[model samples]
Target: MRHEHEPKQRKHTVRNVILTVILVLLVSVGAYAARKYYNIKHAVDNTYQSAGIKKNRNANAVIQAKSPISILIMGTDTGALGRSYKGRTDTMMLITLNPKKDKTTITSIPRDTGVTIPGYESESPSKINAAYAFGSSGTAIKTVQEMLNVPIDFYAVMNMGGMEKVVNAVGGVTITPTLSFSYDGYTFTKGQSAKMNGKKALAYSRMRYSDPDGDYGRQTRQREVIMAIMSKAGSISSLLNKDFLDSVSSQMKTDLTFSDLSAIAQNYLGARKSVSQTHLQGTGQTVNGQSMELMAKSELQRVTNLNRKNLGLDHATTGNIALSVSDASSSSDSSVQSANVNAGN
Candidate 1:
């Protein structure tokens, strides 16, 4: 039941922080749920989605053998938050978990980064996020693997909207902003700590234009809230909410089985250490008329090397990757019709 004092926010309109929230909270919370295994298992089971791609390394074997592995965490702004159509992914993070070393890395891939969606239109570069729309998780995984030259062993996709409910379910989150700004009817000042409910948290994270670093600054605030929620979500009362569990499960689809989560809780507790994040930078260009972010080959190679090192794979330089356009004058953007890229970088 919602608090009568709380004002109602938009019905299905939260952002993608829930992707990381669900990915971690589900596993760590379950680790403490020895008394509620069946219930937790049932909820996780409701989120089963098979990737069906042949892996270079088997996920189960790697986990059972206590080896390192990588996962792609994706969140689509679709099927909820008033987005009824099949939507593209706005949030994509390449995650590597090393249980042997107690370290984890999250590399953010911009939604508008230009890449060829393998099976979709195989002709030219489209934003990396469109890979999900062209084909679901499978194509997205294939595109990321081909471009970055990394093996994705597991993945999870969720409607970004559940974040609001998640925040409220944890009795709301507290945050301190580094800058003061107003967006969507809420305001916060730099260096001031205040408790934020779901709606305010969403507004706080979604404001990028006012930030000095734009989207990267937005990501930092998102991380702050994610850490806040992760810290608060460990309580039994928070995870045992039947209504929250049902709603979250219905919105998520993942290749991780309940057993996989259980194994993670058992063998990979070390991965719960402080997360290190890297952002793959991209420059905007008119790609076939649409504004797309293009990453340089050197940057891709840098990201690839880190992911490979974390996964214990032999380092190999990335090739066949999309390179950024340098000559801006060559773009016939005014002449060519742009592709629909409603989601911005």
Candidate 2:
């Protein structure tokens, strides 16, 4: 009887020890996660900058209500190819997210498209990309609104060079080239899925001249790289790595604060299930030795209608607008626009 009772006590002691260890591990993990969340929140909070523009409705309220919204994505051509100068936005994609329908629409605005910068209305027909260079991101946002007659709720500017760093930060991105080409010491075969590093991803997105579809094809690749990054960045440990955070800190910017971002992520997670990609295919024209993509009035109306419908507005705003920039006619040549500094964790 003594031996049997001793064995029972030993079993109880082992069970208690196991339970204690498990409890300790759970507490440790919870604390670490809390600390990591605090750290990333602080890091993102530091990158916020207001454009000082008036809005029709409260942006935060829209998110809180789980309504659809628009975000202008600008890929600035700075911090790339060893160039340090503030540069024009090389890529502009307008994203509309509708949570109810779980759909996302991306409309690519041509980089060389023409529009009048807000402060310089008399200086009509400046390159749309010049909007940022002349008045920073505010000008760029206003330029898009004025051209499309659609309200832009937020803006995101990413340094093209920093895009490579982000690609690497997420352990690289996987993309299948729709067209076979090579640039910057990288070879891409059509219809092949390749895992691209930072530079290789840049090369894949930046090779416009060789694409059979020209700049439009390049736009598709750019969208592909971006989507890949978004899909991979969330599931990887690099998102919390020190170097990854640093790269994002110096290379990106936006108007959204940490709270705004967190709310959006919580509310809009379903909106990404369906993505429709479209672009403004404009006629390439050389005006005053400057290249331009002339978007027609009808074409403008179509895209605007789509955006408006997604925003729960009427398909109404469409009119004639001369928005092509010429080196031969303007007060100030569009300067290279500085990017906002906000980025994701």
* Residue 92, candidate 1: alpha-carbon lDDT: 88
Pairs of colliding residues, candidate 1: 12-81
Model 2 Cα lDDT, one tens digit per residue, 250-344: 56677777766766666664665655555776777754345667777777887888787788877686634534334324423333111111110
Instruction: Specify the poorest-scoring 10-residue window by lDDT in model 1.
Output: 4-13
Q: After superposition, how far is residue 120 of candidate 2 from its true place, in Å?
A: 2.5
Task: Summarize candidate 1's per-residue lDDT along 1-345 as a digit string, tens digits.
Answer: 121122212110111233344554355345555676666777788888887678767889887888887878887644562343647887788888889888776788887787766775433467787777666788889989988899998888777666676677778899889899999899899999999998888778777779987756776676677667766865556565566566577777888887787777677756655355667887877766666778888888988998898888898978464646763335443222234443332
Full-model lDDT for every candidate: 0.70, 0.64
lDDT of 1 at 187: 87
* The candidate that achieves the highest lDDT relative to the unseen native structure: 1
TM-score of 1: 0.83
Cα deviation of 241 in candidate 2 (Å)?
Answer: 3.3
Candidate 2 local Cα displacement, residue 48, angstroms = 1.4
**Worst-scoring 10-residue span by lDDT in model 2:** 336-345
TM-score of each: 0.83, 0.76
